[model samples]
Target: MLICQLSDLHIRPAGQRYQGVADSNRMLGDAVRHVQALDVRPDLVVLTGDLVDHGHPDEYAYARELLAALTIPYLVMPGNHDDRDRLRAAFADHAYLPATGPLHYCIDTYPVRLVALDSTVPGQHHGALDAAGLSWLKATLAQDTVKPTIVMLHHPPFVSGIPYMDAYRFLDAAPLAEVVGAFRNIEAVLCGHVHRPMFRRWAGTVVCACPSTTTEIALRLAPDAKPASFMGPPACMLHRWDPAEGLVSHISYIGDFEGPYDFY
Candidate 1:
């Protein structure tokens, strides 16, 4: 099945410009349009995290509007900037998010089983998996299922090697690693918080981070760095999976940037 992955929408409050830059909410709108324009409707849409510019109700309201434009059933969780209560209130009807408890849930639809976990620590920028969260994850993985499974979260369990971004990554991930590492059925660990695309192995499984659909974190091969002036080609990821093909990922860059757009 095809799963279109969108992350770091970073939607701000209506009319609130982000530091004299383009409307992040509008850029998110563009991403929705692009997804709608896809030839094959993705079986599902997985929104990784950072759905709002801030944890404000107004920002969530704006995000709620923009996210509703997609026709596909989508799932979401919180990030450092997200307020869980506000997210739950805004999308009360969403299945995976669950109106209460763990801020985690699983979806099983014939060929695929997807798990979305809440990695955001309340009032913090970095991430961690608490005892309760770890217990639930271990139990969930214990279930016998032949369908290919994927676990999605907001923080990358592996270091992105970008010094500044790495500082805010998942802090207590071993409990998380033990659960995922023991699960032979799991295919990949899907995440998005770094605002950059990445693929690497963590605890015997693959960990991937989807790039933002709004402003991207500047390619910081340098230390003590920050995201650049916010004007960059926005992007997202598409993950194609099959029992035969396993898992493959693609990075889609959207917007005007220095490119040939030409034929050889």
Candidate 2:
């Protein structure tokens, strides 16, 4: 199964727009075009979150326009910048979107079972999976372990060793980890919202955090610097799942570029 993962567009509504420092809309546009031009069309597109710069109704409205350009099916979850109610009202017809009011969802299609969980904590930069979400996750994992599963969410369940980000990361990973530990079929835990691609392990499964299609978080691997935002190139992830090979995540830069040199 081929999966296209894009996150952290951080778009704003047309009228209530903000500065174009990130030129997020353009980056997202490039991503859409790239996906459309893919040699092998992806079976699914999973957007992990922060769909807007602010969780305004207008912002959601604008976000609605951009995502509608995708030729394949996609699902989005809430992030620190999203308002659950506003997101639902915007994408009322999305099939994989949950009806439970929170922006969490899942799907079993083709050779992969994709689960998108909500880790957003209202009005906060950090993330969490509450009791209800944890229960739902456990049930989902139980029903299908034989099938290759790729769980999607917006927060990293582990520390990236970046001090500021670690502070505002997923606070409760124990429960999630406990359940993840039990399911070996979980090929990967795909996420975003960190705005920089990061990798880690959770309960024996690989966790891949896709970079943002908007601005990126500056690498402050330091212990004292405040969270820094950068003008680094926007990016996304392309995931390929083969029964024999499991899963592989690849990062793609979507804007203008110039490179072909081999470091190897």
Q: TM-score of each candidate?
A: 0.92, 0.93
Judge candidate 1 against the unseen true structure and give its global Cα lDDT, from 0 to 1: 0.82
Worst 10 residues of 2 by lDDT: 13-22
Cα deviation of 93 in candidate 2 (Å)?
0.3
Model 1 Cα lDDT, one tens digit per residue, 1-264: 888899987788888765557588888888888888777788888888888877788988888888879998788878887888888888777755676765888888746788889998888899898888888888887885556889999999877778888889997787889888887888889999887788998877789889888666777867767656456567878888878889888887776556666876
- The clash numbers for all candidates, in the given order, read 0, 0
Best candidate, TM-score-wise?
2
Model 1 poorest ten-residue lDDT run: 224-233
> Model 2: residues >4 Å from true position, as ranges?
15-20, 259-264
Model-by-model lDDT, in order?
Answer: 0.82, 0.83
TM-score of 1: 0.92
Error of 1 at 136 (Å): 0.3
Q: How well is each residue in 175-201 modelled by candidate 2, as lDDT tens digits?
A: 999988898899999888788999987
